[model samples]
Target: MKMAKIGLLLDEQTANKKWAERENVFAFYMKEVLDHFGIPYQVISENTDPMEEMDLLIAGLLNESDQAVQQLISYIKNGGAVLHLSDSPKLARWAGCQVDCGGPGYGYPAKELGYQKPVRFLKTNHWYRAAPADWNAKEGFLTDGSPEGPVIGELWMTIMAGSGKMVHCQADLPYSIVGLQQGLEPIHRDGVPAPDGTAGIDDGLLKADDSFTMDWSCDRETTDTGMNYFSEAYADRWREVFYHKLAEMALEKGLTVPFIGRWPAGIDQIATISHDSDFNLEESAEVTLSLLKECGIHSTWCMIEPGYESGMYKKIKQEGHELAYHYNALEVENGVWSEMEFKRQLQDLKTKTGLKHFCTNKNHYTLFKGWGELFEWCEKEGIQLDQSRGPSKKGNIGFLFGTCLPYFPIAWHTEKNRKYDVIELGFLTQDLNHHALADTTVIEPFLEEVQRIGGVAHFLFHQLHLLEQPKVGEAFRKVVREARARKFEFWTSEQISRWERARRRIKIDRLAPSGEPELSGEAPTASPVIWVPVPKHANVLGEEAEIRFGHLCIKKIPVFKQAQTS
Candidate 1:
C-alpha cells in the first residue's frame, strides 16, 4: 500500500565520508535504479534506529564496526530487511553460517535467476566462498528450511533469518546497476570538471536556447549493460530481480514495475529498422531500400555519400524514408575538417535536394566521445534527434546508457545549467553485431530475442551488408515478416521520433485508491497510447484499470500486481 522507504546508512561515525564518490559507482547505480522505478528512499544517519526509522537499511553499514554488524544482525533477527554487496563473510554469519570467500571472482550468472539459459541476470561470476547456504548439495541434506535462498549461488545467498531477510550478494549489484565501474569520464583531482566533461557551459557552446542537453551517460534506461564479453540489451532485460524483491520485501503490499513502451493499446515492445552508411557506396543500397519498400515500410538512412545525382538516393527520399546525416569519425580523427565538412555537406544536401530540415544524425563511427562541440553544431543545424548513444561499445549493442529507448540528452555543468533540444535514440542491435562484428550468418536468434523482449529494436543494417549477397536482404525481410506475424508495427526513424515526442507529454497524474486510475497528459497523435501502473494493493484486486488517448479508450486491463515479496 506504501512505497519502500530506502536508506543509505552512514557508518557509526560520520567523519570524512562521501557516499557519492565516483568509486562508489554501485551506490550511484542503486540511487539511479531506485529513482528509475519510482522507489522512494532516504539517507539515514547512523544515530537513527534501523528497526524504527527505516524499513530497510542498505547493507554497506557493516563495513564500519563489529557493533555495526551486531546491530545489523539484531535488526534482521527482528524481521528487518537488508541487501549487501561484495563477498563479505558477515552475510554468511547473518545466515547463521560461515562464507567461503575463496571462489572465482569473475562475471558469471546465478543459474537459478531465470527459466532460460543466458538469462539477462549477468554477474562477474564471483562465487560466495562456501557451500550452498542452508543446503548441502554433496550430502543432499538441509541445514535449515524456514527461509530458503531463492537466488542460491555459491557466491551469494538470501536468508530469512528469524523474521529478517538478508541478501548476501557477492557478484556486486553496483556493477550491475552501473556497468563497468568507471561509467563517468575522469574527473579532476578536485572533482570539478571531468576530463571529457565540459569545462563550462560556454566551452560546450551550450546556449540558453530552446535546447535540452541530455547526458545519456547518466540517465535512466529501460535496462542497459555494456560489459565486456556480454550483452545487457535483451528484451525484458530488467535483471534486478533480487534487489527489486528485496525492496518489495520491505513493503507490506508488493512492488510496482513500470511498463516501458508508449505504443498504442499497451504494446510491450516497439520495433525499428535503420541503416548507417559508411564507405559502402557499392553496398546493397538498392536491394535494402527495395526490400523495405516492397514490405510497405519506411526507414531512416544515415547518409554520408553525396547522392544528389543518384536515382537511388532520390528513390530513398521519395519512398517516405528519412534522410539522417552521418558524420565520419575517421575524418575527425585524421584532422580532415570533419566539423566543417559536416556543416558544408549539410548545406550541400539541403541545397541540392531542397530538403527542409535535417533533423536526425548518427556519427559515422560513434565518435561522440562525450563532447558538447558536436552537439553544439547539431543544435545550430536544428537536428532534433541523435542516434549515436545507442551502443555501450563501438561494435556491440550492449546497454551503454542502460536503455535502448529515446530520451532528451541533458548536459549540466557547474558554471551553467542547460538543456540541449536533442532526443538521443540509443542503438539496440544492428546488422553489424552479427555479420560484421561476430561474423554470424543467421540473425534469427537475435531477431527472436528482440521480439521476445518486446522493446524498441532499432536495427542498423548498412545496405552494404547485402551488396554481394541477397541473403542479407532476404534475412532482413524475414525479420520484418516475423515481426509482423508477432503484431509488431514497423515505423521509420521520424515516426518513432515523433511518437517519443508525444509520449513525453503523456503523464500519470495520480493513482487513486478507488475509481479509474486518474491520468493526465495530451497526445498529438490521433491514436496515441499510454501505460500506467494500476491502483496498487487491494484497490487493484477487485477491478481493472483503464488507459486512454483523449475520448478514445485504448485499454481496460486488469491490475496485475507485482510479485509480493514480504
Candidate 2:
C-alpha cells in the first residue's frame, strides 16, 4: 500500500479566527492519532500555491472571501479531494452539491437551566447518514428547506462540489476532518478556474481516489439509540437493569465504567435535592455518604440553590459527596432576566459554594433561550463541562443527541459572533423523560444500545421520590454489583472531569511540535507496613494479639494445637 499525502488550505484571517486556532491545534493532535495508524499528512497555509501532487486538499475556516473561494473551486476542479469545515451552504451549492441547513438554531434559556426535549432522527439518505444512526436527534433548529421542513439539522455542510468529491461540515474542521482524509479520492477534470489562478479540473490526473469509500466508516450500521419508556410503572426497574447491562458491556470492552458503587461501572446513580427545607443537610450528607460507603459506592447529589439550609453546601463537601447545581429558575415561571444578569447569578452562586459544575432541573426544556446563553458564559468563565443538552418536551421525547461520551461544544453563532468555549458531557440516560424506563423488558435492549455506542448510563433519582421505595435502591445496587463483577470502573463527576482534562492534554501532546521531551513517569510505592502488638500472655510458638489504631481496636487469636514446643 502506497502512503498517501494530504494537504490543508485554510484562511488565517476572518470571522473564524478562533476556529482557525482550534483547527491548528486539532491538526497537530490528529497527526499523532493518524500516525498511530500509519497515516502521513501535512497542513499548508492558504497563501501557498496549489500543489497538484497531493492526494487530498482540505479547506479550513472559510467565509465569503471571493479570492479564497475561487482558489477552493479551482483546487477541487483539478482532481484534488477537498474537505470543507465551518462554512455555509452557499459554498456547497456553488461547488455543485446540496446542503441542508438544520434551520434557525435555538439557544437555551437560563431560566430553563438545560434542554429537556426528546430529539428524534429524521430519516435521511445523505452520505453521512451513519452519524444520525448513532446519534439521537434531540431538540435543535434544523436548517430550512429539507424534507423534514424546518427541523434541527444534525449534520452541517462544510465542503461542497466544484469538480471533485468534496466534504463539507459546519462543525470545526479538525473535529470531523479525519473521516474525510481517510476516505475520499482526488479526481482532476478539465474546467476553467473560476477567476482564480489555479489548475482547472480538466487539467489534472486522478491521484488514487478513495477518500469516502473506506470500509471502516464510523456510521456503518444504524440502530435506534433513542431513549423511550414503555410504561410508567417499570421506569425505575428498567433503569436498574439497563445500568447493569451497561457495566457488563464496558467490562467486556475493557473500558472502566464508573458509577455509584451500588450500580455497575459506567452506570451512575444521581440523587437530586430539590428543596433545602426538605432534608437536613448535615444529617443527610453524612447518612447518604455513609450508606454509599457501606455499599462501596459514591453517588452524585444535585443541589437546588436557596432551597437548602444555611451552610449545607460546606457540609455536603465535607462529607465527601459530589455536588452539582440544580437550577430553580423554572419555579418562578414568569421571571425574566438579561443574559448578563443570568450569568452574574450563576457566577455568584459558584463563588458562594465553590461549585463550578451544574445540571438544570425541569427547566432544561427552555434551554434554547436563557440557558444556552448561560452555557456561553460558562465557557467564558472557564467552566469545564456542561450536562444540560438533554431532550425536552418540544423535541423527540427521551432521546440522546451528543457523542455517547464527552465532546467539545459546536460553535453557536449569535447576531454578531460565534462561541465554542464549553464542552458537553452527555448524560447516558435520565428518569424524567419517562421513555426508556417505563418498562422492565426494555432494560436489556436499552443497555445494549448504550454499550454499543460507548455511552454512560445515567439515572436521575430524587431522594424524596425514592425515600418511600427502598426496592428502588436495592435494584440500583444490584445493577452496580453486576457492573463491578464485570470489572467496570466507577467514577464521580470530579473524577470524570479530571479524566477528560487528562485526555485533552494527551490529545494536545500528540499534536505538539515533535522532539518534545517525553512526559514524566512514576513507579509504584511499597504498601504501608502494619504493626500489630502481641498480647502479654502470648508465647513464641503460638500467640494472640490485640491491636489498636486511632479509634479502631481488634483482638487477634492464634488457633494452634499444643505441638512439641521447647
Candidate 3:
C-alpha cells in the first residue's frame, strides 16, 4: 500500500495574500492543525494545482464556483477522498441536505463519538433543517435530549460518490479551533469576577483568560457550583476527533497518514514543573530545589525582581535546572505592565543572575492586556515560550485555555494575519493544594488526557507555596512520581522550546512515487520519533522501528528503502 499524499486546497484568489487578509483563512488554520499533528501535506491552489496527484484533499474553505464544485465532485467520484471544513450549501446538497445557520449554542458530541461533555463554538455552526436527499447520509448530529426536542445540529455528513467519498462538516471547524486556541482580542476589560471565585475577573486588570471568546458560564463545565475542575480541553478533543476521522478516511483509501509524535522517543508523555519565585526567597527556593532534586526532576524557575543572591543563582544553575524571568504587573511597590517595564525586568534578570538568555516567561499575576501585545513583546524580547495562559483560580483548574500543546499564535487581528515567533505552552493549572487551587485531583485526569493525546502537561507552583505549604509539597512529590510511573519525562521550558522549534524545522519533503516518505531538516535532540501507519507487510527505513500508540514509531528515518515483507 502506498503512503498517502495529502494536499490542502486553497482558493487561487487568496493564495498569495497574508492569511489574515485572505477571504478564507480556514485552510491556513487547517494547515496549522496538520502541522501541530506533524502530518505531511502540501498546499494546492484550486486554479493551478492538479488534484490528480493527491490521495486525500482537505479544503480550508471551498471555492463555491460551479466549475470548482463540479471538479471536486468528479475527483471524489473517481475515488479521491475529501474532508471539507467549510459550510457550503452546494456541497451540502451533494451530502443529501441543504444547510442553514444552526448554532450560537454549545455542540455536544453524539453518544457514539465517546465524549463526556459539550464543546462550545465561537460562531454559528452549520445545521441541516431540510429533509435529506438520503435518509442515511447524516452520521453525526447534535441532538437535544427532550423526547420531543428537535435534532438541533449536525456535525458530519458522509456522502459516497461512485468509487470514493466526501465527509462534509458544516461547522467552521478551523475557525473554532483557532479562536479557542489563541482566544479573542482582550477588548472587553470590564472587571467582574465570578461570584463563586472560579475566575477573578473583577480585579480591574487584563489577563490571558480575559481574551477568551467563550462565555465562562456556558462554555466551562464545572462541578459543585464552579469550585472545582472546570472543563476538559474541548478544543484539544476536537482536534483529536478530526484527525481520527482523517486517518479513517485515508485507511479506507488504502493509505496511511504519518505524524510527528508530541514527545521524544519512548516517552509516553512529557511534563514541565515551573515555579514562579514570587518572594525571591533564597531559603524557599532552596527547599523547592531540594524537593525537585529528590524527585530527580529538572524544572524551570521564573525569577522575580530582586531575585536570589548571586550564590543562590549559581547553585541553581549548577544543579542542572533552568533560570527564567517572572514579570510582575500587580501594581504593588514596583509592579508595572508595559513594554518598557517588561524589558527592564528582563534586563535585570540578565544582569543580576548573570543569565544570558531567558527563553521562557510567565507573568507575575498572569497579567495580560489586549490580544497579541504580550506576544509582540515576547517576539521583541526573544522569548521563545510562554506559560501565562492557564487557570489562576481553584475553580477553573483544567484545560481552561483549551490545550496542553504548545502553538504559535496567529495575528488574526492584523492586516496580514502574521504568525509570531514565540510559542504559547498553556499550563493546565497552577499550585496544587494551595488557596484557590485544586489538589492532586486535577493531576490524574489531566495527565491521563495528555498521555492519551501525546502532548506536554505543564504544572506551575510558586516556590513560596512549596516551602510554606506542606500539603502542596506532598502533592508535588506525588505528581512527579505519578507522571514518572506513567512514563512521562519531566522537562524544562528551555528544553521544550528547543525540541518544538527543532521539530518544526523538519518537514516531509515528499512521498515518493515508490511510496516512501522523504524528509528534510536538522534532526531534533534526544532521538525523537515520527509515527507512520504502515500497511501490514510494508517496510520502513529507520534505525529502529516498532508498533506503539496504534502507529509504527521510527527513531530515525533512514535514507534508503526496504523491500516489503513477503
Which prediction has the highest lDDT against the true structure? 3
On residues 15-43, what C-alpha lDDT tens digit does candidate 3 reach at each position?
Answer: 44534453436446676678777787888
Itemize residue pairs with steric clashes in candidate 3.
27-60, 193-202, 394-436
Q: For candidate 3, which ten residues in a row score worst on lDDT?
A: 140-149
**Model 2 stretches with alpha carbons more than 4 Å out:** 1-56, 60-81, 84-287, 307-315, 331-371, 380-382, 392-398, 415-419, 431-443, 482-487, 507-566
Q: Give the alpha carbon lDDT tens digit for every residue of 189-278 in model 1.
A: 121221232122222211111021122222212222321212344212333344434433443324222322345554655667778765
- Residue 264 of model 2 has an lDDT of 21
**How close to the true structure is residue 246 of candidate 1, measured as C-alpha lDDT?**
49
Model-by-model lDDT, in order? 0.49, 0.36, 0.72
**Per-residue accuracy of model 2 over 421-450 as CA lDDT, tens digit each:** 455543433333233233222344334444
Q: Rank the candidates by lDDT, best first.
A: 3, 1, 2
Q: What's the count of clashing pairs in each model shown?
A: 34, 81, 3
User: lDDT, candidate 3, residue 498?
Assistant: 93
User: Which should have the higher TM-score, number 1 or number 3?
Assistant: 3
* Regions more than 4 Å wrong, model 3: 12-27, 65-71, 89-97, 104-120, 124-129, 132-138, 143-150, 161-164, 191-197, 213-227, 509-518, 534-566
TM-score per candidate: 0.59, 0.49, 0.86
